[model samples]
Target: MSQHSENTPILEARNLIKVLGGNRVLDSVNLDIGRGRVKVLIGPSGAGKSTLLQCLNFLTPPDSGHILLEGREVNAGSKKELCSFRQQVGMIFQDFNLFDHLSALENVRVALMKVRGMSKLDATERAVAELKRVGLVDRAAHYPANLSGGQKQRVAIARALAMDPKVMLLDEPTSALDPELIGEVLTVIRALAQGGMTMIMATHQISFSASLADEFIFMEKGRIVEHGSPAELLGKGVGSRTQAFCAKISELTGEADGEFRS
Candidate 1:
């Protein structure tokens, strides 16, 4: 897959603001993600990564802002627009939000059968193909309760992939898994990136982001404080706060293969 062109942003956020419980979760946030690029969002726990993802997909309406998807305006003002916006953006959560009662294959088909107006047979074919892409083909008949964390996450990815979305948004996608399980999920993400899928992922895995992301966005105090390629964001003489956070996470990880590997 080719890298998306830099001329037009596939997803753009302008002066986005989101308030929760009277606290500003996202303030004056602005970003432009190139089409088919892999972008990473890194910040402290409360820096608003999750909220920004929600705002992008209409999971949580922003207080005030402009979101342009493929250059079309999507905001909270219009209910009809929100529904359309969601169909174009497929979101994957940290938790595999699967219905325990639904079989893995069923979960993938439900959205397509209901939203895309596809016949049950066609939906099953697409769902099965997506599950195979995520390496969950054999487990498609199993329930969430019977699958491993990695398997469940793969199912979630398949579900999102089945939508054939224009943009993919992930919020802390590896947070709930054990360290060993992280690699399996990241493998699927890397494959997606290699396929030139436009993505915005909020993650704590510095090494993965350092290697995979086309650009990095750093947030603090509910706003984007830095935006650049990974080399630029983690380069020498970066702002003290960003470097400090990076160093701390590096130390915690035990094995460092990033900017501070020396």
Candidate 2:
């Protein structure tokens, strides 16, 4: 790879397509995200935002597409390659996928010991540090059942961060939380963004995303309908799909137009 390619996008998805049950969900999607940049995906429910994220990580492998990391195409045919790819591209789901039997620390520690072959002592120390990063160190002994929605989500973030991924794919991370609990999770995400974490997040938190995202990508009917910086897309009279969608969301959420529109 050339130095320019290495200097550009840290991750790329080219012509990604996925069909399920005779219906095309992700249609020829293309995306590029550079290191330390944050992009937000916005669209209606079932717009294939989740599918795109899953496909990028090969959790739900695309029927046909190319995913490149640092300008090199991903080859997930080998189990070892897939495992390494997944570790590099950490994923956080809407529902906190913590192990029910493990405490917060153990939940973060398990993958390190199992996948990375870290010693138990090393994994435990790393887990403690990650939990502290997410502000959940005090709850390290609590299981998912005992943690609040926000706390569980924090633990999930910590688990992913523990791997030191090159990119983080977030699929509606706050969608499961109650209204009062959403801010805490968003705060953690905001901190990550400020700390230069690369992220591609699919979310409906338009106002929050517009404020933080380097770009807003709008998908509809399994395709990217619009893409641009938040100011370019959401500024008054821009007349973009993203702008209109955000307007509708603002109406539904009862936020003022000024909040979602620049």
Candidate 3:
């Protein structure tokens, strides 16, 4: 088993709650992700997986709860602290939020310059390195409109990686791609996981989650109903609700056995 200390979690959420239109989206949700471990969030639609990720990064601050990064409380109320905190916690969205006008290289470079205050030359070098890491250095000059969905998302990943984030929050990184394109993005993510990058990902790709995650969490009605290793949760030992949900997802994706190549 992977070892982790109880006294410190790389990232943690305590009693996180969010209400939208008087409906509670996150009902006092709590979780802990250890350093260099990958945790995949899986559940039915509208189970608050995305909301939980957003709250963790303060993209959508929770109505109540505390967020701790490296055991230090993240005070969203303080501008300087929040900015620094956000820099250390990178978020990737399903929509591939690349600048329409900027080239892939510039997309990555701009963040390093603006956020980290790196010189233009230094930022460009760092950006090239990151794009290369995502296997998109050749497409450096392509703008978002010119690139395919997979390439665009790769650029987005490069942008986040350029910041040298301590924890990565990916909200369905492969959900927006075509079937053929999904593998390329998943390849990069798998590489990152293998390299021991700490991550919390919300995705419907059950096979990938099962194979790569250190722990799998099943959320429903904004609460974590079950959580365990892939061998336990995806095996015959899970509860009926979780098993039924997994079966349904498999039926929808046509990967009932949950076997997939990254």
Q: For residues 108-227, what per-residue lDDT tens digits would candidate 1 score against the true structure?
A: 999899888899999999999999999889998999999989889889989989988888999998999998999999999999999999999999988787789998888887988887
TM-score for candidate 2, please give it: 0.97
- lDDT for each residue of candidate 2 in 1-262, tens digit (9 for 90 to 100): 5778658788999999999998899999999999899999999999999999999999899999899988888997988888898999989999988899999999999999999999999999999999999899999999899999999999999999999999999999999999999999999999999999999999999888888999999999899999999989988878888888888889888776684463
Two-way lDDT contest, 1 vs 2, winner: 2
Ranking by TM-score: 2, 3, 1
Q: How close is candidate 1 to the true structure, as a TM-score?
A: 0.94
lDDT of 3 by residue, 1-262 (tens): 2343545798999999999988889999999988899999999879999999999989998999999998889989999999999999999999999998899999999989998999999999999999999999999998899999999999999999999999999999999899999999999999999999999999988887788999989999889998888777667655546566777788878885643211
Q: Which window of 10 residues has the lowest lDDT sum in candidate 3?
A: 253-262
lDDT for each candidate structure? 0.87, 0.93, 0.90
